[model samples]
Target: MNEKRRFRQRLKDFDLTLPESKKEYNRMLFTPVAQVYSGITRVLSFGRDAAWKRKLISLLPEIPEPRILDLACGPGDLSFLLALRYPSARIEGIDLNTDMLDRAASNLARMPGNIQERIHFFPGDMNELPFNDGEFDIVSGGYALRNSPDLGRSLAEVHRMLKPGGYAAFLDFSRSSRKHTGRLQLGLLSFWGRLWGRVYHGNPEVYGYIAESLKSFPDQAEFLRLLEGFGFSPVHYLPRMFGMLRITVIRKN
Candidate 1:
């Protein structure tokens, strides 16, 4: 079979509730589209993806030579932004998909020597990061949490990776607790996402995964509770696009 057929078959067979399956599905979904991931994000978000990321970075407090971690750093957009905002900081980006990592690496190569030296990308899972406890001063994840195969485990890992008083910020689609409202949100997201997926990849399921994943993700309030339960204190919450998207900053306590 051809690549598109294989992708559709895998998407149909994979179960999002299973962590390993979700991880593998994500790899299959993104690998073929890594080159256009950023562009698609801009289109999907109505040209606000970059602005949302910039707002996320602005929420972070300045730290001198801080060590930063960008989890699920697809194409290293947030990682590069953090590097530019904090020139002396060392930024490490980790993602499950190697194709995305390759794109990030390619982007890094074109940068000047100083940024190229400070930023590095690697292949890894967020739920089981290969780093020491309290290793990072700041951790940022753009559209990361909602995509995690195991959100609680991933949040626990984020808590474990951060130093005391360190901050972590995440930008992602927000869900509502109310069933009807959530269904409306998911339906709209799925329709728009699948439209783009069909246009770009000739497969609606390619981007429809976003809505499917969000179906299992916690709503805003529950998300905040999860963060607090994982030893993080919510510091800033910025809702954009009528609460459909949010940038949340929390501090490690």
Candidate 2:
């Protein structure tokens, strides 16, 4: 086998590099190569990532005016959009990656006073959110849930942090339940992920964790059950990108 093939084989056997934890995952992708995350999102979402984010933002209750929490708000892509959509709402974000938070702050600082004033970020853990109980009206996570180290507790924290009738809207990958289709999807995504990673970061494995992580992510039905078990009532979700991704909108009981 060629050197590149051998290298990947070795990595497959031992690297096990994945954003699957509180510390290891936090430190894995926030390197310089992570600058391409937004672009990769755009391409993979068919230039509709922004629109999808907007849609996720819309899933929240807007009338009473929300105290918004954007968990794992990397680079503020969705947070910034939330600010534009809810100029007066209080939008706070918490993340573990300082580099991503720096980027998020820089982007937030560029907005007009009306928007910039309402958005902020800090270091936090999903299993133990820094906020008090029932502290928010709407909680939105952009591609954050699946990456969580503890999905149960991460969601439990969401339930704890939101007021009764509060909404939780999130976007993330959805592993197809159909075994054959999932394999095909994973193959295509792996090829595309490696290509994008190599072209943008000079590291073919930069985004390979996406495919690896999806392999273990719960299928949609199971995920919905998990959310329900957490007492998030009236849960609803919509698949995006031909079911490659999904948006869940659930209300705290």
Candidate 3:
């Protein structure tokens, strides 16, 4: 089969609602677009991608000699940012996508030795992390939660990996509370994603997964409740781009 047909078949065969299927689907979906993911994200967000990420990093509280994990750390943007923000901190990034990890490695090589020494990127899944319990001071992910095959399990892992009072910050597309508004946001995102997907990859479905994923994601209230259930307390909540995107910071109790 051709590239497009193969991708379509993968999309058809995998059901996003199932945890394992979503994991496999994401691997297939991201491999082809990993190289252009960062650039395309900037375009799709109308140049707000970097600013949103910077804000997510800024929301994190200060910690002395912190150990940080950037989950779903595609291209290591958040990881590198965390290193810069906390020079004394040790940063590790984990992602399931090997192609994205290669891109992150390339990005890491261009940094100065001091920064390079403090940051590491590896292959791992959020639902099943390899770290010890209470191993990190802070955890951050950009556009992370929505992509999780199992959101609650991933949040549980984050809570498990964080020390008492440690913070977990996430930036992702949010579903609005109002039904009409939610539908509008989904439509806009789907159109924008597909437009860029076709432009860059010659397949509209390449990025259309964003809206599909968001459909199953909980809105702000339910999201906060999930955090509470996982023994996290909300620290800060900021909505951006008319509530289509949100940055949430929570502390593990």
Measured against the true structure, the TM-scores of the candidates, in listed sequence, are: 0.97, 0.88, 0.98
Q: List where candidate 2 sits over 4 angstroms from the true fold.
A: 1-22
lDDT by candidate, in order shown: 0.91, 0.77, 0.91
Spell out the clash pairs found in candidate 3.
Answer: none
- lDDT tens digits, residue span 64-150, model 1: 999999999999999999999999999999998999999999999998899999998999899999999999999999989888889
Error of 2 at 65 (Å): 3.3
lDDT of 2 by residue, 89-162 (tens): 89889887878888888878888888877888987777778789999988889878876777777888999999
Ordered from best to worst TM-score, the candidate numbers read 3, 1, 2
Candidate 3, 79-113: lDDT as tens digits? 98899899999999998999999999999999999
Clash tally for model 3: 0
Clashing pairs in 2: none
What TM-score does candidate 1 reach?
Answer: 0.97
In model 3, the Cα lDDT at residue 118 comes to: 97
Q: In lDDT terms, how accurate is model 1?
A: 0.91
